[model samples]
Target: MQSIVLLLWLALCAEQDVRERQIANTLTLGVGLCALIFLFVTGHTWIGSDAEEAGWALAFVILLTIPGYMLGQFGAGDVKLLAALALATDRQYLLGTIIGSGVALVLWLLSRRWLWSLLSQKVKNRLKAWGDESSKKQPFAPFLLAGFLLASVWIH
Candidate 1:
């Protein structure tokens, strides 16, 4: 049940970002807060085991990821989503998620550039309107979702 919701949330976030180049804070915050509330009331998350010092864990994660956010390496949405996942899982799972996301991002960047280079001018022009610039920005939510799901599966 929780996995289904998480997958849906990831999909929604990715779709919003790809379509609008923006992510909503409401979604991230709402998920995080709900998880926090669930933890407080039930002593366990919807997905993972009972959190030990969950507040400290959340704070640590936010602090740890903030530098990347500040450097524009990722959006605030990524940070919030990770923190929320931390609430849903444990530190070990979060590490796996980060690693998986990083690998996917690197591969995506390489493949996208290579594919763009192979496209014809007409195709490139059409794709450009869809915001496909080989050297331009790319969305991270999909990669994050991939990593999150992969990590969740592997960790469990």
Candidate 2:
């Protein structure tokens, strides 16, 4: 049930990002908070205090976000989504998700660049140098959803 909601949240976040290149802070905060509370209520804590665990998850999300934000690859929402996932999964599943999302992110970036290289020479060169920061219609939520699912399947 939690996983399903997490997947749905990621899907919604992805759709919003693909459509608008932005995600509301309320949504991310709500999910992160809820997950933390749920974990605590369920007596399945991560490490330290819940607040500390949430902070750690947020840090992990920020770490993943740096590259994407630096290369103009993704938005803060993506980072928040990953952060929420990190909180939900906690330390136990963190390793799997990191591996899963990392793999997906690499593949996604490579493919996006490969397609960009097929554009005009000038555009291709520019893309090869700095990459496109343009907003477009691509559903990336599915990839994230897949990553979470795959990690859950393999790790658990």
Candidate 3:
């Protein structure tokens, strides 16, 4: 199950990185629906056996992220992705995932300057076309993937 989630995250990261930073609804919603079905069929979730925990996790993620969504700080796809992940993760580990994402973002921000200098001219030009240095926006799925991996390791 964890491997499947990792593969899904990898797909999302690839899409966000290579494409226009848009996440497909089919992927996000399909993952969420599958998670719900898994919980129903197995009486288990990443958090526990309770289906209510999954519901609360979904609600918590929505409540937590909706403000950012409304403020345009986050795209709809990012919020949906978080919500789907919430349904699949334990509440305790979910907090760790969120914190890990922040840590990953900070690390990337600090390292990107040095890393940028090492990139080939063509790659640099392409990255520049993706976004300017001043913009805070960048593909976030990678950070999410890092966080998910970190939380998985830390908790288990």
Candidate 4:
């Protein structure tokens, strides 16, 4: 189950990185639906046996991410993906995922800024001119994926 989720997450990250910064509804919603079905059939989520924990996770993620979504700080796909992951993850591990994602995002932003500062003014101008609009917005899926992996390892 973990392996399958990891593969799907990797695909999502790849799609977000290589294509436009949009996540497919098929992947996000499909995983969510599958997690729901798995919970019904097995009385367990991907990471735990407690259905209530999954429910809480789902609710928590929705509530937490909705404001960001509303403010346009997060894309709809990013919120959906996080909500789906919350459903599949144990509540305890969800904290790790959230924290890890925040840390990763901060580090990525800082590193990118640092790297940009290192480039010559002419190079920066040329690169900025060549860069597409999509490059300006960092994709969240990869950071989320990294967080998920970190949580998985930390918990196990």
Report backbone clashes per prediction. 0, 0, 0, 0
Cα shift from native, residue 50, model 4 (Å): 0.9
User: Where in model 1 is the C-alpha error above 4 Å?
Assistant: 113-131, 134-136
> For residue 79, what is the lDDT in candidate 2?
68
Off-target runs (Cα >4 Å) in candidate 3 are: 1-4, 46-49, 120-131
What lDDT is reached at residue 132 by model 1? 61
Between candidates 2 and 4, the lDDT winner: 4
Give the TM-score (vs. native) of candidate 2. Answer: 0.60
lDDT of 3 at 127: 61
TM-score of each: 0.79, 0.60, 0.81, 0.79
Candidate that beats the other on TM-score, 3 or 4, i.e. the better one = 3
Model 2 RMSD in Å is 7.4
Instruction: Please give the range of 10 consecutive residues that has the lowest summed lDDT in model 1.
Output: 126-135
- Write the number of the candidate with greater lDDT, choosing between 1 and 3: 1
Error in Å for residue 95 of model 1:
1.3
Which tens-of-lDDT digit does each residue in 1-118 have in candidate 3?
7746644664665456535676787767877777777888887774463677777777878887899889888778778777777777657656776788889989978888887788
- Model 4, range 10-98, lDDT digits (tens) per residue? 56654554356778888788888888888898888886648888888888888888998888888888888877777777677677778
**What tens-digit string does per-residue lDDT give for candidate 2 at 8-123?**
78777765655555667877878778877877676544332355565566677777677987787766666676777777766445556667766886787778767665689865
Instruction: List the global CA lDDT of all models.
Output: 0.76, 0.64, 0.72, 0.74
Q: Sort all candidates by lDDT, best to worst.
A: 1, 4, 3, 2
Candidate 1, pairs of clashing residues: none
